[model samples]
Target: MGDFRRSRLSSTPVVGRVVEWKKTHGWIEPECTIDHPEMAKHQGHIFVHGEDLVPKWRNLVAGAMVEFFLYYDGQGLGAEECTSRKVLRVTLPWKHAKEMFGESGEKLADFEQQTHVTIRAYQWCQPDGNNSDLPFLLFEIWGRPQAVVESIGALAARREQDGNAAEDTLCVNLLLPESRMWKVDLMQLQHYCSLEVSSSITITDPMPCRTLTIQAPLPHFRSSLHALIAQAACVGNLW
Candidate 1:
């Protein structure tokens, strides 16, 4: 019982080995290079040569592998090389994701049980660059809870009226920063059966063009709640 939209585009996965460390153009940090076959000849796929190289953002030096999953919509002149515009969907190995979960490892299982909330992965372009050393990718956490969602809406309204008061009030902040690079929207779904937290990042100069959605069940909401509470508890040294 899933609702899907007809899409005009398609996606594919691509992986390229790092060849060199590229420059950030005074815009982005932790930049590097890849020997992607498609990028070599495509007009849209530009390259950073000798003068354009930056030695500072060379954390992932030559030989570190790079992998990205992109949606390819047929367009541009690289039809021979790759006819599609790269959709900005990136994925890292599961091991990498596990490490990013921090100390919430055991707590994650409890969280999943209490709230049917789900966390999704996403990627976006680097706008200001090295202002943050984090990846453009992020994880989104969201869930479905009818009563809680409606109630929180009102709560947020009240907070807005209270001059947005409080230095340390347990305010139900909808948007929480997982890190400097990613932001999550905590919302309850219509049915309250579960919760869904999806993560995505924008690509290209302006941003990504596709829309994203997450579906969940009631049990998922419980799991999500458990995780959220555990996170707060950990931060408060409750564990």
Candidate 2:
């Protein structure tokens, strides 16, 4: 049997928005509530130190998005391995498009028209040390066209009408490299799998990138992920 010791801290990173930042320390309002029972004892904000910031930034502006692993040092919940999420507009290439939206068939044409999609990119900091100049890598991309959303909504409604549970989630897929997969501990991944934010991950066959599909809750997805799409859409409207 595998070792089943589960740490109270989070192994996978969670998304959050910065609440405030002092010179040395700050607080972040997590996108989802922390599930640990001990979390009720303190305010919901996650403590973050300046040193923990990836690339070692001095101050984080309020409302800036970030991702980090959660930790509790017997005192309070804190954030570590923090990194800022940079949102940008990206046009997916045909090969990439085939992988993500191939199921859409003729609808792929519609997706092509809406090529300028919003994605949250993160700095690829080195494990040994931080390098401020490293280019940002795309972490999360929203490619769901309006037609797809309507289709999903209809399917959900039908399920609810049939007395089945409604599926209210947006899939957040990750494509991770096979070489790095060995370094990740399956036990730790299993532990975090119970959380709503990390539950939808599915590891498939060996691929060039780290990929998993996560069924993110619709409400949280709207507030965090879809908000970027809305902002990008507004910008497009201005032009």
* Best candidate (score: lDDT): 2
* lDDT on C-alpha atoms for all candidate structures: 0.29, 0.48
lDDT of 1 by residue, 12-116 (tens): 323333344444311111122433444344433422223222232223334332222322222211111111111111122334445544433444444433433
Which 10-residue window in model 1 sums to the lowest lDDT? 77-86
Largest TM-score belongs to which candidate? 2
What ranges in model 1 sit over 4 Å off? 1-101, 104-106, 121-132, 135-137, 146-239
Residue 36 in candidate 2, Cα distance off native in Å? 1.6
Error of 1 at 18 (Å): 34
TM-score to native of every candidate shown: 0.20, 0.36
After superposition, the stretches of candidate 2 with alpha carbons farther than 4 Å from their true spots are 1-8, 89-239
Q: Write the per-residue lDDT of candidate 2 for residues 1-239, one digit (tens) a residue.
A: 11134234776678777888887879988876788766665477888888788867646777666778887776667888787654322223334434545533344344433542223333345567775442222333323344223322221212132353454444433343444445444434333221122233322222244343323345443333333333332111111
